[model samples]
Target: MGLWTVAAMTAGAVGAVALVPVALGAVGFTSAGIAAGSWAASMMSSAAAANGGGVAAGSLVAVLQSAGAAGISTATTAGLASAGAGVGAVAGRLIK
Candidate 1:
């Protein structure tokens, strides 16, 4: 409820939102593609296996792949921002 808490929450929220793309990229999810032998590739493999050798549409792996290949949609971005804000608020409270 204080100034510092609000600032911390804002910063945390912004940081979480910004870091998502970078984190995805770092784990081999990029505009290019899922890098071979990378974590993304592994996830794809597992998802495919779980779905009888095919990655089902709308699955987590599929969604992430889509986001990586293209970019996150507005809805997804909004969801991420909300999650980020929630985490930020928690962090702010804890820090205080």
Candidate 2:
């Protein structure tokens, strides 16, 4: 694999890790939190795509939902979505 491949994977992993709280079934985040995350992730995905980046929409949404439902912060939601989108895009580019 190329360096980009590795880097992209790392980013994806980081984003996924951020949402780890959901796996445990309770993290104090509410439904609004998840919705916010999903919205942010959608925007992030669009932004990435507009900039000529492409990450699987399903994956992006899934990650954001998982993260949000797990109690992810509103303040950090945008940042996480952006980061995850970027990483997923990078990974898609490299792997493709």
Candidate 3:
């Protein structure tokens, strides 16, 4: 794809990802202004057992930490995509 096209796609993807929280909140699925990172990190630990099964504290912590890390990683990926798109556009222009 052309560099400008890639840039446009990257921007659109980032925008879509950024809207996730807003959409979730609008649907009453998530609390307003609460970061997804915090939610992911605490959700497992805060959840009550559905089947009367208790989760081990240590395991719960590990799961929550991993989920939080994943959420952060997703944001990082979007940022990197945006940066790369800018770089690609510059390089493409210079090559012409």
Q: Pick the candidate with the highest lDDT.
A: 1
Q: Best by TM-score, which number?
A: 1
- Off-target runs (Cα >4 Å) in candidate 3 are 32-96
Compose the digit string of candidate 1's lDDT tens values, residues 1-96: 877678777777677778888888878888888899999999989988888999999998777878888887888778877777787788778877
Candidate 1 deviation (Cα RMSD):
1.4
Tell me the TM-score of model 1. Answer: 0.87
Question: Is candidate 1 or 3 superior in TM-score?
Answer: 1
- How far does residue 15 in candidate 1 sit from its true spot (Å)? 1.0
Residue range 1-96, candidate 3, lDDT tens digits: 676666665655566556544544443333322244555324433553532454455564444344333443665557656765665566555555
Q: Candidate 2: lDDT of 69? A: 58
Which residue pairs collide in model 3, if any? Answer: none
lDDT tens digits by residue: candidate 2, 37-74: 44454565675676578545566544555555556667
- Work out the TM-score per prediction: 0.87, 0.31, 0.33
Preferred candidate (lDDT higher): 1 or 2: 1
